[model samples]
Target: MSEKQEHASAYWKENLKYLIILLTIWFVVSFGCGILFREALNEIRLGGFKLGFWFAQQGSIYVFVILIFVYVRLMNKLDKKYGFDE
Candidate 1:
């Protein structure tokens, strides 16, 4: 492949890596904390609410937002690295 094509391919691969990692984190937090591990997490409390309940109702949303920001930052760095920032 040409150098430019190779760069594009690498950039796409890196982007996919970032997406997979972030989505997996989100899935674990939402599914594991909210359902699978709810009973275990319920033993803990945050601001008077059970941890698992909070994860189901609010924590997942918070995590998703945070992940959005994290993805933005990561993408910015990736863009710069790949000369795509322009």
Candidate 2:
């Protein structure tokens, strides 16, 4: 491949890697904590609510928002590394 094509490919690969990682985190927090590990997590309390319940109702959304910021930060760094930043 040409030099530019190689860089483009690498950038895309890195982006996909971050996407997969973030999605995995989302799934774990939303589904694992909310359903699979609910019983265990319920033993803990968060603001008078069970941890699992909180995760199901609110934590997942919070995590998603946090993930958005995380993704933006990561992409900024990635863009700089790849000379794609404005």
Residue by residue across 1-86, what tens digits does model 1's lDDT show? 99999999999999999999999999999999999999999999999999999999999999999999999999999999999897
Specify the poorest-scoring 10-residue window by lDDT in model 1: 77-86
Tens digits of per-residue lDDT for model 2, 1-86: 89999999999999999999999999999999999999999999999999999999999999999999999999999999999999
Worst 10 residues of 2 by lDDT: 52-61
| lDDT score of residue 29 within candidate 1 | 98
Off by over 4 Å in 1: none
Candidate 1 global TM-score: 0.97
The true-versus-predicted C-alpha distance at residue 39 of model 2, in Å, is 0.8
lDDT of each model, Cα atoms only? Answer: 0.98, 0.98
Q: Can you give the lDDT of residue 66 in candidate 2? A: 100
Task: Give the distance in Å from residue 48's predicted Cα in candidate 1 to where it truly belongs.
Answer: 1.2
Candidate 2 backbone collisions, by pair:
none
